[model samples]
Target: MMLTTNEDSQLALECERRIINAWPALSTLVLGDWVLRFANGYSGRANSATPLAYGAELDDAMLDMLEELYRADGLPPTIRLTPLVAEATRAAVLARGYRVKDASFGMIAPLAGLPVSEEAELQIEARPELEWIAGVAARQSGVKTHAGNLAAIVEKVRLPAAFASWLVEGEPVAFGMAVAERGMAEIGLICVDPAHRGKGLGRRIVAGLMGWAGAMDCHSAYLQVEQSNAIAISLYRSLGYRQLYAYETRILD
Candidate 1:
């Protein structure tokens, strides 16, 4: 079914909120309708600023204050240009010499008709265990250095969450996670072993998480993927997830 313009806008807004809630920051400061987040420099989504409302604008004074706050926290001045941000606000950040990076798509699919694989080997825990974190760190290099920070972030999640993994010969080969709130499931942390490529393990892993999401009464599920990742994009598209919005960060180092 096609979404009306207003329905699309509201869905994007809900996705933005669920994304922020699922992967929380250690601390957050609100300036107007923007949220300035910090998580000890773990990930851009956790440490940069985000707008909470559509068409939100930022003045020079507000930008300066946000920059100062980030610097005080030992982080670079960073702002995420999500769909909620105004074009003028984005232009202001670019004018201030904030370099763009990590362009990505926020995709979502309704859970009512989404298929979930009935793979018996997939394992899921309501709370992530140490092995799941270690498995993710082993597969994704970006998280290796931030393992402790990742643990800290996940521990702070108060919503209904699922940590999933697939083991081969008693060793983890794939991992994924899902957090459900307000009838929306924010699915992420999907990783599969390089040796297991082309086996559809990634899809199975996502299905495992979605299976859990459906059980939680989530109406829809969402995930973010870098635009450059064509393979991952194809995988998600094949599973009925469509781009709701795209976002990128502007950083001042």
Candidate 2:
């Protein structure tokens, strides 16, 4: 059953909270523009020896922590806020004269009722064709494909448990990926080759990923998508996925 708007939003928030808490060491660091850059399993000492040493509340800690990030990076700092937490955090940022930008949606599914359309001609693949996937990403985003980008995603799939991909006629078409962690696999990097879109290929690929997650004994799958991508949002909704939360960022002027 499709979730109500309120239910979907709540689910999104819960998913964001879980993801952030699952990897506190990585999630706690604020990157270039207050972006929660690398939060799964990264660890390094902050620039300040006692940046987070105080037992202050989250907001206070974050505010104080921002200075350290700026001092370390030597740049005008920005902050990343997840929509689920934005309401609580926005006032604080505004108080600091920071404005928000770049809002995105966090969509998710429980892997129980993803509709697998029979008519879509989908061919499941065990591994992604790196060159093709990169090419598609580059074309869609106008960015050149780099070896490092491909390598990082490949390494992610090589983790102990991960999701697979789908192709059409031996050509890389769409992909869905997940990283298993703490009883759930956090889905990421789901993309459809623009050339093959509008043919229900995205749904097939997602369905295949859901099936893979279920076979691995995972309880649910989650992913983030930009809120502006209406087509994608609709497709996900048709496949039983729903928004769990929203994240927003404001580029510092």
Candidate 3:
């Protein structure tokens, strides 16, 4: 039994790693002065401080690289960072005069131990209702017209090998997306409609997504959340996500 548990844990960690590598576009690579440049898009190979190698020494090298990239592409000026993990790196950022504007938490849950309540009347759909899913997410996040665009993007990216789920009543109410790449499932853009905030719909959506991942033989799942969002942190904790790490940076405009 103990051996099985250890294997499961290892598998979960591996799955998480794969998910991060799979979705390079949504992934954060480093920090700059004005933009949180993502590894997604036309950005070539990612070269940022690894979780283990990041420290105060990284400040100069990272800043230099960020500046080079910033000038070369004429990208917007902003600091780049992630809410995933970079506690040590983030501390260095704060020491360098970067104030925390927003915060999110990293949360995870083992698929085997998920606590989904059947009483919630939650239903998991295979393909998300792109139109409805995007609208709900945009309204909840205050990103106007983002839903339509996001739906198109998701349709193009989500493959059978990857995992995606929508929490619905008669129509989609919440959505969660994940991809299995390196050996883990990376979860992103989890959203619940404002009208259904307290109804445990978000948890259901996550649970359903995890289930899909598990079905695909994924071992673990991971996500990034802002540090200031305490309510979300609480929800993830309730679902058994412990703090593995923290990441932060400033965005200069």
- Candidate number with greatest lDDT: 1
TM-score of each: 0.94, 0.66, 0.63
Ranking by TM-score: 1, 2, 3
Give candidate 2 regions above 4 Å deviation. Answer: 1-14, 17-64, 67-76, 83-88, 113-136, 139-147, 153-163
The segments of candidate 3 whose C-alpha lies over 4 angstroms from its true place after superposition are: 1-22, 26-62, 71-98, 113-129, 142-145, 148-169
> In candidate 1, which residue pairs get closer than 3 Å at backbone N, Cα or C atoms, i.e. clash?
none
lDDT of 2: 0.52
Runs in model 1 with CA error above 4 Å? 1-4, 114-117
Give each model's whole-structure lDDT.
Answer: 0.86, 0.52, 0.50
Model 2 agreement with the true structure over 143-211: per-residue lDDT tens digits? 224434444444444443433445567666666555555445566556777777777766776777666
Over all chains combined, what TM-score does candidate 1 have? 0.94
Count of clashing residue pairs in every prediction? 0, 12, 22
| Candidate 1 residue lDDT tens string, 132-224 | 887787777753456788888888898989999888877889999999998999889898889997898998988778778887888888999
Displacement of the residue 75 alpha carbon in candidate 3, Å: 4.5
lDDT per residue for candidate 3 within 1-253, as digits (tens), equals 0112554444434433443354333435434322233432222212222231222234656756754664554443234344333456556655566554444444556666443334444444445565545554564434323555445344544544333334454566666666655435666666776777788877776666666667666656677677777887787778667665444435433
